[model samples]
Target: MAKDHGPTVKDDKLYEDLLRDGASKGKAARIANAKAAGTLDHRSSELEDRSKADLLKEAREIGVAGRSKMDKAALVKAIRMG
Candidate 1:
């Protein structure tokens, strides 16, 4: 059977915060906040110039592991981080 790895320290805390507010948030929100706070790899400013397709290609080139599954916005985020 596959193992169930629990949430990381950071994710756990963020989830808790969402719960406290009675607003269930998705992974994107957590990722965005982390990025904004300079904790995640990508900064919002860096992705401004690229088109979505270009961003996805760049993300793949930069070795974002799940590039195939990522959408344009997510690709932008990952590329910036990478």
Candidate 2:
């Protein structure tokens, strides 16, 4: 059975699964909440389909440093690795 993670954890089973999958606490919580709310997007756009500007914007949003110096391919790699 999944251990109780307090009220902040909306979905205990999802949280436990995420934890077992090596997800950080915050990431697990966000995913669990999103799943519970039916807002979790399982599908993502292909990296090649995204524009350089869009990749850069996402990198910036995710706090990827030196994104200004990276090209589209580099941004894609960094975003994936991040």
Candidate 3:
């Protein structure tokens, strides 16, 4: 069983899985909560369509390593693979 992460974490198991997958604590909590709320199914822009800055921001959110040194295409790949 997973340890309780307090009330802010709506889905503890999903949050733990995201953490194991390299997501930051905040990102894991947010995604888990969104999944519990049934709002994670919304569509977003393709990685290519988003600006490099946007990609960097998302990479930072998801705890991608070496993101600062990567270019736009690399950022897209990292974000996708991440």
- Would you estimate the TM-scores of all the predictions? 0.38, 0.57, 0.54
lDDT of 1 by residue, 1-82 (tens): 3222254324555555545665434443455356446766432445766567767755665567988888777787675454
**lDDT for each candidate structure:** 0.57, 0.80, 0.84
The collision pairs in model 1 are 41-81, 42-81
Candidate 1 — what's its lDDT? Answer: 0.57
Candidate 1 clash figure, as a count: 2
Highest lDDT against the true fold, candidate: 3
Model 3 TM-score (2 dp): 0.54
Separate clash counts for every candidate: 2, 0, 0
User: Which stretches of model 3 miss by more than 4 angstroms?
Assistant: 42-46, 49-82
In candidate 1, stretches whose alpha carbon ends up further than 4 angstroms from where it belongs are 1-46
